[model samples]
Target: MLKENLVNILRTLQRERVFLLGSFVTLLIILGGLGFSFTEASEGGSFLKRFGEGLWWAVVTVTTVGYGDVVPKTSEGRLVGVALMVGGLLSFSLVTATVASIFIERKFRRERGLETLKETHHILVLGWHHDGETLLDQLLRRLPHTARVVLINQLPPEKMEGIRAKYPGREPLFVWGDYSREEVLLRANVRQAYKAVILAGRNEGETAAEVDQRTLITTLTLKSLSPKIRILAELLRMENKPYLERAGADQVLIRGQYDSSIMAGALASPGLYKVVDALLNAEGFTVWAVDVPSEFQGSPVKTFSDYLKNQHQALLIAIFSEGRALSLEDLLGDEPSSIDEFIRSKFVETGMTHLFGRAKMKFQINPADHQVLGPHDKAVVIAAQPPNL
Candidate 1:
């Protein structure tokens, strides 16, 4: 491992020739200063004072600072100063160009999606649009300041710049590419991400199938990379639901389903949509997950709700259970209609599929108020204050 690391260091130095050259020049200047300082000390000068003066002279000459507070009276020291001043000019030019080139290279990498991110447990957003910006705003408001968010989208660096400008004080890294490609996904560090929110990708005049197809492709790639990551995907067609789950999506939301329901309700009763919107506002209501208490096992659901509200000021809303999330019925159909089912079922038993999807939860909303709570059940609650993470 040490030998491999040495080889990598050598390769890095070779690539960063300007850095190597600058270091060499600095060493040479320091050695020259030390020699001159020692020579002066031999002539009854204080060693530390002479050495500090020599170093100061070397820096001032190199940077063209030349404050002229101290000067070497010896002929040999003057020649040394001239050589250092010349070398300093060269080094200064090299350093300035190197810094500029580094910025240009970073710009190109951001434009072409070539940089690999090294963050852990950050939220990875797969698709860019107005929805991406809205999600970012909501995430910042909900999460702490230290939380990081990354985007993998087809937006140019210019649009990404606009995003940064519009959302000042927060910097989000973005990779520009088709997120389904393994290289692009790795560039975004999908395996290390905590959760991925995949918005359906579409262009102007594109069909629903085409948009959901892109989302499916991205989901499959994400699942292939990390099964443990929580994946929330959007689907336009309800028929495409099983496909997304089989691709290892943890939470699948149908497009227009929530909005259409709210709109229909509004039609029946004017201003009903406003009430629902107010209730679901990102800042107004918070949905949190709470641990199941051992004492509440087999107790009535209403009893648990009362305990939570009285103790923690939270309202019991739903039960989130990891069990029953996946089954032969979901992967296959009511009947095993084809040989494909045999192969696919066995394929899912592989390590990768088990890693990503086997831990998915089945959220049951408003379990009968009088129903008994199970041992492994979690209460999904709406509360003014957040539950412990």
Candidate 2:
């Protein structure tokens, strides 16, 4: 504790050295002015009156206010005034220097992403991409207005003027740096974050592969720092999905694949895009993950489906479990099962089974009645509005 206190004191001194110097000089000036006041008390200056007046004069002198309410009547007092004037100049110089340094330091943090945030339960958005503005808008609309956020990306400081302007008072802290670096992640406080969304910053580098590669590196670094943090990452290459999964990313979006699939769907089924757009809209009827009834546990999938339709007045579309969507892959005991196993084992090991219990996500359009409902099974229902998360 003593060593920690010493380190803290040193840090404070380092940070406030200029202010401290100004204060020291101001104190000296006050003392000297008072000494001169005492020396010249018999020469038309009152010792008690002049000393009190001298202190106020010294302050006004430092501030360059020059109210002139009090004046030194003796030569000695005039000499003290000269000393005070010099000190005043130095003090004001220090004040200007401090303000300029503070502005420069803030600019440096904005440019280099050097802020070490220590907030808890914050949602971190890493890697600003081509779609970043759109993402930001949607996120702002969907998330609670009060949710704290940190955005770490490689965008230059000047390029972020739009974001600052748009947010006005509630701008998510912008950490302009390489997200793949541990120090940059530290700036965003990955360990304390509730979740993270990693965008594929195509503009930061050359090819799609390059973007995905950087994203993969960032995912690995984040997982290494905080294994429990839920990370959603975008990958341009489908092949990079495995790396993200291995790196413990909870959700991975293959950008090219989704765009291609959606385009194909649009081509095959005209107006399908409109329906999807409506479903994904932040403020509209959208697919939401909701808790299954406690009574539905161990019941067949059909039972929960009926309950959701009857009770919530919603369509039970799918169940999302583990990390990604529950699918035919899970029924086949393939990818989803492996991930589920990993999640189960990890949750049990860390006594975080409650989180898993709350995150039960399984899926079926019209599942067989024989298939039982599992604990932590959340129902993805198409509802009129999103629930409070």
Candidate 3:
């Protein structure tokens, strides 16, 4: 293991040209020291006559320090000193230029969005549209100050800078490219991401269906690369929701689905829209879905509600369950019949295995106080921030 590590280190130094420069400098120092000692050997009482003193003089001369404490009086010794001085100037200048060029190249790549990111567990946002700025603002507001976010799109560097300036401290990394491409996704380190949001982007002269098609393709690609990444996708048409769901999206939302209802409510009752907008976009507080603790498994909904209100100052608005509530035995039934086996085989052959155990995420907006909490239940609450529980 040690030998392998040493070889790796040597390879890196060679790639950086540090090894070559170091070897050259070492050779010059050794030759200069030996020559000085040999030439000054006849000068009795001269410090340079000693090999150790000669080495010290060589070090000082090569570094351009010129301490002048041990001077070489002989002609041959002075000639060695002149050679060391010229070599020192050339070597140090090359080293400085090499270091500066490396830094400049890295900066250039980053600005062009050509640098690959290595962040893990980061939020990935794919595609950009008219409402992208608003979406980014809400995400930044809800996320913790230390959380990382990466944006994959074809936005210009200047536009990215403008977006960063708007959000003061929370700057999302930008990777410029066609987001549907696998190479671009890999550059953003999508496999290690925690969650992804796919937006319905608007391209020049493209219809709603065309936009939805792009979203579907992106969802399919993301799931194929990282099956575990949770995806929330947007659709321009409500009819395209199923396509996104089958493409392995965890959540599918239609654009403007609630706008009509909110607008109607505003017409019926004044100031209704303001209240709803505040809840959705307010920085002080927002609605959050929190997992129910294990200790709350068979407790009544009213009890959990009271505990949140009293202990954490949070309001529990509803109790909901995500995905199918099924056990391992239930999922893989008592025994697969001949017909079941045949159907499973067909699904695998058709590349529709994703639909075998698929279940829609269900939410119960409000439940009776007597409702008992299930093991996989989650509490929908309104609080200043998500509760630790």
On lDDT, the candidate that comes out on top is 3
lDDT of 3 by residue, 203-274 (tens): 899999999988977876786677668888999999878556655677888999999999998898858777
- Off-target runs (Cα >4 Å) in candidate 3 are 1-13, 43-49, 166-169, 324-359
**lDDT score at residue 45, model 1, on the 0-100 scale:** 63
Candidate 3: TM-score? 0.83
Lowest lDDT block of 10, candidate 3: 325-334
List, residue by residue over 285-312, the lDDT tens digit for candidate 2.
Answer: 7777777667888998888777667766
- Which candidate would rank higher by lDDT, 1 or 3? 3
**RMSD in angstroms, all models?**
5.3, 7.0, 5.6
How many Å off is the CA of 232 in candidate 1? Answer: 1.7
Q: Which candidate is the best by TM-score?
A: 3
- Which residue pairs come into collision in candidate 1? 227-356
Judge candidate 2 at residue 50 and give its lDDT. Answer: 72
In candidate 2, list every pair of residues with a backbone clash. 319-362, 319-363, 320-361, 320-362, 321-361, 360-376, 360-377, 360-378
RMSD of 1: 5.3
